[model samples]
Target: MVRCSHVHLYKNGKCNSWQIGKEDKKRMASNQGSSHLNGHSDIFLATSRDDQILFNGILFYLGQKYIEGAQHLPWWRTDGVILTVLLHAGPVEFLYYWLHRALHHHFLYTRYHSHHHSSIVTEPITSVIHPFGEHIAYFTLFAIPLLSTVLTRTASIVSFAGYITYIDFMNNMGHCNFEHIPKWIFSAFPPLKYIIYTPSYHSLHHTQFRTNYSLFMPFYDYVYGTMDKSSDSLYESSLVRKEESPDVVHLTHLTTPESIYHLRLGFAYLASEPHKSKWYLWLMWPVTLWSTMVTRIYGRTFTIERNIFKNLKLQTWAIPKYSIQYYMQWQRESINSVIEDAILDAEEKGVKEEGLNRNGEFFVRKHPQLKVKLVDGSSLAVAVVLNSIPKGTTQVVLRGNLSKVAYSLALALCKGGIQVFTMREDEYKKLKEKLSDEAGNNLILSKHNVPKTWLVGDGLSEDDQQKASKGTIFVPFSQFPPKKTRKDCLYNNTPAMLAPKHLENVDSCENWLPRRVMSAWRIAGVLHAMEGWNVHEVGNMMFDIEKIWKASLDHGFRPVTSFAESKAN
Candidate 1:
């Protein structure tokens, strides 16, 4: 193994770390995009045949100039090589600015430039991962600095070598996932940073796009008024642990067996002091083990953007790009059957024409004062409807945490229209608080109470009349609550339609342990069916599971299904 030097630079920040050295041969052969979990790629940093060809050509061209008495190359002349690099950047930057901008045009981005943007989280190698045409153009523009030195007869091999070295170094630094530069780097020099762009500044271009578009300097972006405002703070927090959203799939991720080996390191955290229950870790340990075993025995399902698969030319077990038809028949009438049965149940409760769904406007008879916009349907005439009331409607009826029902609600909130979410006084009050905190500033979540005819406004600051035509919401049940009168929160003479205490916790158990366990099994079901994991991915997962299994065995845990465990309980 080679020594891992250069750790000091990005040690604190979260960026793709790179070092100038020989790389592993095995990694290059696999040709995978990045470490699926850790998100890394070192192949781009390794010297390839293409680099040999380009550098050979450059050396040959420089060799001819060396014979023409260019040996001194301002070495002992009027000034130093740093002056030559700045001079080189001027013309190159001007030429590259327009070329780079042109590459972002729609057709060019799809065909050529978008390849670089394929990796949202970039590494040092990602810096040089441009298409052939783009790379060829880049090499040509970069050589202009050398060509000008030759044409003007102003520099030698040393100056040209140093100048090119500076260019490559800056390019690599821009792509590194870490921002090593301290705040005092600017405060100490002040003027130096105004010209140079930081790694985070360059990262924004990859993640956000349409801003910070200079070759190496920030001067052009400032002059063109295209600089991002949050560049500084974004850089500082780049390495910090991001606050997670409650509805994110990663929340349920099992990092235990993977990190169980690090028990000594995490022992303190597991032995909670306060706030968290002292027995929280011990209590959840068995639950975690059970959930993990269920998931391991089954498998997992995950989705990456289709473009990533296409761009990487990855070998997928399942089709990368999918049409609507691909997902339509997959459920095999199960969902259709459920909807039908639910609809039949609704009719029995005398729920006919309970609400007026005229054109796009809707008015529920139960909440007579409410006016709503009935947005388009989600699945099988199940509409996403939104409306506002006098004091504001809140308190949606769904309870269990992060189920299919909760996922649907999260998706509805993310429709770019939902501004605020309100919860009710229930057993899930703590969950509500956690969800609100994790949601961050993206949404306004509160514990306010409202009737069951829930409303999610369009999030516009304009008056209700002006924004009446645009908003979306969803009711988890097959039909809206059948409230015939203002005081009615349920259907007439039907206790099933009323709030039943027994059914409230049917989807879950104490502290939602059963829900979490079931969700793990559900994930396995998806993974077993999902066609994406390649042979290599499958091998890695199987290996991890073996280790987890051995670890569980040592702890007296015998993996068993809930059906078997429930009877014992």
Candidate 2:
């Protein structure tokens, strides 16, 4: 229910709700209260939806069997439309207002209404998650208008269908947790306030528990003096467009073509997990192909998702280019333009710091004088790779395309008394030059020695895996994950930490990272803002690994093995 693909629920990052896959029961128990007791289960939501369909069917059957004018086929009737609206605005709203207030009384509230109130931050589906007894009472109350219209011979199919559609629209809109009802309408027509209630108004009913009891219309709440005192101000505050400012921006890009669907604006379910090639997604290849083409021509960076980490606002921005495009030699200038534009745009928006993926290093070299602090997060990533090496391991193979993190990881490992071996003489020389004389003593260049732990990076090949011993663990030091070459060997996820449970609106996974897990590159920008550090960690310079590691732990970020643990589970 939390991450259902509802249009009203997700637009503009307005809804403040989280859960997508399996419930983090231990983490959820601290906050969700009794709502954690099976109400949020997929089965409960499915059954609740089915029950409403069944209830509507029974109502139709009764009407066709007993009502005089229920089976009529006229499509439109002006008189019927007028009568239905009048009936709802008068009797339907009045009676339901009382019924709703009555349901809040202690006896009924405990048995039925509390279930609906459990979701303090609501979704569109939250409007229907109620006990069966409550559904029955609601169906009967709603049937008043239909029954009255049918008996009076003023009912038509349009009037009946239109009234039902209105109810569904109003119910979903009010619970969507986003204020879609523009305040300008109320300003233009002052009397419309009595007839319409905004999402903020209904939200108060759930939060305050006793006031603002009207359903879709606020007339009764005003008449009875039960409306919340802050409804108008709250509505105004939610609508005011504040400046576009964020504490940190994680600048990344799309990966495989299938990654198009993994964006938050894309499919909800796919976005909530690691990227995987799905057979069903192949059927959607045309759309994927079209999207890729569009991005190539568009050449801009756009926000894919947003989150609130503690009190800070976080955003993930994606350059229109894909990972494959970044590899193409001809696309370098175009790619640079897209990335530069994104950083400048972030700077213009008052972004304090911007985190870059590995490919973004080009911008640091090209535009060294830029104001916003740019971080590559190599320090934390190096720390993660070093700590991931199994305990009591004396030696490990370091392979693949040598990056700043890879070099730093090798040096740190050699410095710690663990022997670092490299098969490539060129990579060995590159790393040896950067190490201290004592640390360099542990670095060995050889092709014959086999180590069970291989610290790999980008461009790891199938041949590399074949040379390694069977069941070897491939731990990645690169921003992107290495392709799995041997099913017999274990692969770990890249450097990331399990995000705190309190981070709000984290409904999607970060690339291949698990639910609620954040990549170190992304987290580095956040740490920069939290620490109020003003330095740009670009090119060869990086923050102290120990300091970043300690800061991450202090902020409740627990280290996770790249992919080994997730694959095992």
Cα RMSD, each candidate: 26.4, 8.3
How many backbone clashes can be found in candidate 1? 6
Q: Any runs in candidate 2 off by more than 4 Å, and if so which?
A: 1-126, 129-134, 140-166, 182-197, 201-237, 241-244, 285-313, 348-350, 357-371, 414-419, 425-445, 500-507, 561-569
Estimate, for each residue in 1-569, the C-alpha lDDT of model 1 and write its tens digit.
00000000000112233222233323321332322222333343343326645864776567666756445455533343555676655878877877877876666776667657665667777777765677678778876756566666766667776776777799889888777777777888877666788888888776555777888887777777878887877766764543211101110111233222112223433312211223445665775576446534533322110111111111101111112222466642443332223223322322221111111121122223321111111111111121111125433433223322233444344343444343434424433443444442334444444234333222212231122222322232221122222222222110001111221222221111222121121122112112222111110012132332333223222222323346689
Write the residue-wise lDDT of candidate 2 on 1-569 in tens digits. 01100000001123332222334443333332455346356777677778887987887888798877788558887887898888888888898899999988766776677678767777899888877887888888788878887778887899888989999999999999877678779889999999999888898877776789998899999999999998998888777745446667777777777778887888998888876768898999899999878986887767777788787877777777667776789987887677677777766665655555444456667767766777877888787777788889999999989878888888788888989989989998999899999999999987885799999988888888898988899998877788886889888888778888768899988877789887777787777777777777766787899998888888888878634467688
Best by lDDT: 2
Best by the TM-score measure: 2
lDDT, residue 41, model 1: 30
> What TM-score does candidate 2 reach?
0.70
